[model samples]
Target: MSDKTSEAKVHFRSNAKVHEVDLRIREANVRLCQLCLWRNRKGIGFHIAPSSSSLPVICMVESNSPASAGGLKICDAILAVNNKNISEANYQQATTIIKTALNTKGRVDLLVVEQKFYKELKKNDISMISSSAKILVTPHSMPADFFNFPKHQPRTCDIHVNQDNKTFGFEVVSGDDNIGIYIQEVAPDSAASNAGLRKSDRIIEINGTYIEQDSNMNYQHYLWIAQASVYVDIGDDKSKLEATKLFEFVLYENPLHDNARLNLAILHFNPSHVHALETCAIVGLQMNHPTEAFIDLNQVLHFQPSSAPLLANRSVIQQFLDDNRNQSC
Candidate 1:
């Protein structure tokens, strides 16, 4: 068995050769490519970045891994998975398709083209990928890396529980990034801070137990369904946090989903569908996480620039941050 707790990503990449890809085209200019990977419960060892308008492109492949053995290369634009055309799929959609196939089938067949070739086709306004090709070009909703990753990379913090304190001095919380739970509010001079657990740093595991990607979506979706999209008890802060994890997982499975985005935010128990950033700016502010509040407000403002209430809320969060900075100084 592989040395992995789950197939969920938080991992490695490497370099090999182009021999892993089965070339469908004869010319170097030919963009069509293919890769059939044998996957374990863990995952095919590779990372894909959204490129060329939301198309999943092979960005990293680990050495001695299924993807590397299968001949997947960086910049290979994924066209379809398991023979389904995803020429127009966003990063979330593509990931969902891939995850669904991997979970049910235990193997994945990918149809891809080199990034340069896809760009060439786009440059010339070629939608039809040759009459023989299986995938037809679709319009792009993802213009680029809409998922702006934080400046920091994932790091391991070796915080030993103090014998006296017996606490790591941090709280775990789920946020918009569907990756993992983050370390919230590290106490200075405590085990977590001494080990470098900064605010917003994702906690990948605890005591050697890896947190898998597959989490129950019941709190947000099932409850919403049971009530016919109405009347979910937002019981308490802990309950809301649990629902937040559900929202993250649901969003992970389908980024374009309105329910995961909107319902959780506007859960005044109303029936009408909603969608505006993650849960709410007020929720983040109430939790005393100004950065998150700002992000939520910023996301809403991007779509509803004239929303006065949202703008006012953003101003409040901004002022709070400024005051905090001055205090620290």
Candidate 2:
């Protein structure tokens, strides 16, 4: 038979929960492979050895053999083959599964756990070659709300200010031709500095009205505009920080209506902020804005092309966009 036909003959089976096992392996930074092994009538292609507990382990893989090409490594624990759970079976039973698979098909599928997981199991005093099965927790058994609950919410705080307070100890500048207001400076003892309001915080709203950049307004008017709206910043050093702190406290407690998206955009302003880009892309996907998500992910991939997680996320977004386009047609 041709190499392709011969390779297709081998089919291996695994007893371990594929997703759970794959997750653990990935967490452990181990590569997992589905091997297709083929043997002639004389069984010259592959060889297996029994471990101390009489369970099968990969002892040797021939160079250029089907096993080697399939990424079977030395000392890999044989978990199952062709639906047979070798962990609970004797050497003969395991070999029988391999032999039966080879006879029925031209090749057999071998499912083996990588060495790292085996070492971990051994380090924990668990027998690596034992016939006892390890029971894994299934997702269906978890609480119904386990995946539905939000893990975190925006933190809020309130700051009280006396009427004597004035200057908040910060300078505000219109961003990019007076399009939006941003914190330009925080004085050393200013209220803004004390309130955790970082420089470059884009002011989205004042009191209840959202601040808009108006080229017609002068910078001084913008500064004095919010004076009567519960907080004002003056030239005094003593109350500057206090008023600024109160303003920031109120702002943090009541984020803008589109705070999530705004926060992500602000974070991505730093070019090397990969996590920010990743979060932006994820939030975009969640909001059904695949185009936005793709833009963020593409920018990230340009920085780290080999990032597997980023590539996977991009693929998902691409698939979603493709599916949506197809449905619209």
Candidates in order, TM-scores: namely 0.29, 0.28
Judge candidate 1 at residue 192 and give its lDDT: 79
Candidate 2: global Cα-lDDT?
0.52
lDDT of 2 by residue, 203-233 (tens): 5545445455544243333344344233333
- Candidate number achieving the greatest lDDT relative to the actual structure: 1
Look at candidate 1 and give me any clashing residue pairs.
7-42, 14-61, 20-71, 262-274
Instruction: State how far residue 5 of model 1 sits from its true place (Å).
Output: 66
Error of 1 at 299 (Å): 70
Off by over 4 Å in 1: 1-24, 28-41, 50-52, 122-329
Error of 1 at 265 (Å): 67
**Residue-pair clashes per candidate:** 4, 13
The most accurate candidate by TM-score is 1
lDDT, candidate 1, residue 228? 28
Model 2 misplacement above 4 A: 1-22, 27-44, 52-54, 119-329
